[model samples]
Target: METSQALLIYNMASVEKCPETLTAVNASSKQLNCSIDTYGNNQYMCLPNAEKSSLVEFCYNGIMGIQVEGNCLEAKDGRVILHSCKKFLSGCPKKPFFNYDFYKYPACQHINLKHFCYESDPSCQALENSGGFNNVSNDNRDIMYGLIGGLLVLVILTIVIAGFINERRWKRWWWSFTGVGNEPDRKPDKTSGTTTNPGL
Candidate 1:
């Protein structure tokens, strides 16, 4: 695909980290209002239902994807759903999972990953091809920058050339206005062997 087409796809992945508010659905099908809280490890957590949950802590680790406990969440329609494994049954069951709505997150519109949660989803397939666009976008950006630089150089050259031409014209005008260097060539007349004045 062309770089422009790939850029559109790549831009879709660049999302905002925070928004005015966030909404989520818990395992109980209860709608929860979540808030963002940043920590020291370049990680952040979501506090659900206006308070903290002891059993379920939704945190986003910058390295991978969003996670609750240790399990990765599946992204869909700008939201992430956590499918708990059997071992974490005490915290979250396999039946109904915890879903966090990151639709309001401006930096990243969507998150896609191949994990325990809905691995067969189409978004997961997109993740497999996401790597190709990065390099393509970088090359395109470099080309764009080069084009801008070349235009700047052309503008400078144009200004320099215009200045040189204008300076010559201005000097000629000034000399004529002041009647300087307007004298005719004072050559001797061949027949008379003497200089002749045109005014005489």
Candidate 2:
């Protein structure tokens, strides 16, 4: 009889200092309504005091999936619940958990972690053998920059060539307009009118 080997799975462990929630957006005006530039992606608007200065910082990785641990979330009324996911944040949870509607529910059920599980923002499985498009995106950006640089160099060369041609044309035009000793190979033409001015 053939038997199947069980798959090994690991739970990711993370340390959360503060159980603060977050809202996300760009623009300083909106950030003021939300919070500070923590992620710097300008993706998340923050909630006031939602983040702890020391312990709230979390580093999650794709290797083991994810898990979160932080101070118990305390509601304004003083009820506490385990703060594991983004729901406990001052802002909306963007993931497996909640949204702005969560705030509408009574505080009695606000602290639930069942909704959040570590997930690939884009299905990681789709990019599995595709050379990690996220990583490749950076290389593509570099290639674009190089192409732009090459184009700029070409433009400068074209401008320089055009200017050189224009300079020669201008010199020819100036000689034709003013009739200055422009003939390098011909001698001056003279007529005998006893003193006829050749310039006339």
Indicate which candidate wins on lDDT: 1
Q: For residues 24-121, could you state the per-residue lDDT of candidate 2 as single tens digits?
A: 12332252333223333221211111221211111111121111222222211111122333333233233432221222222312221222211221
Model 1 CA deviation exceeding 4 Å by range? 1-136, 182-200
The positional error of residue 17 in candidate 2, measured at the CA in angstroms, is 23
Q: Specify the poorest-scoring 10-residue window by lDDT in model 1.
A: 1-10
Every model's TM-score: 0.28, 0.28
The 10-residue segment with the lowest total lDDT in model 2: 43-52
* lDDT of every model, 2 decimals: 0.36, 0.32
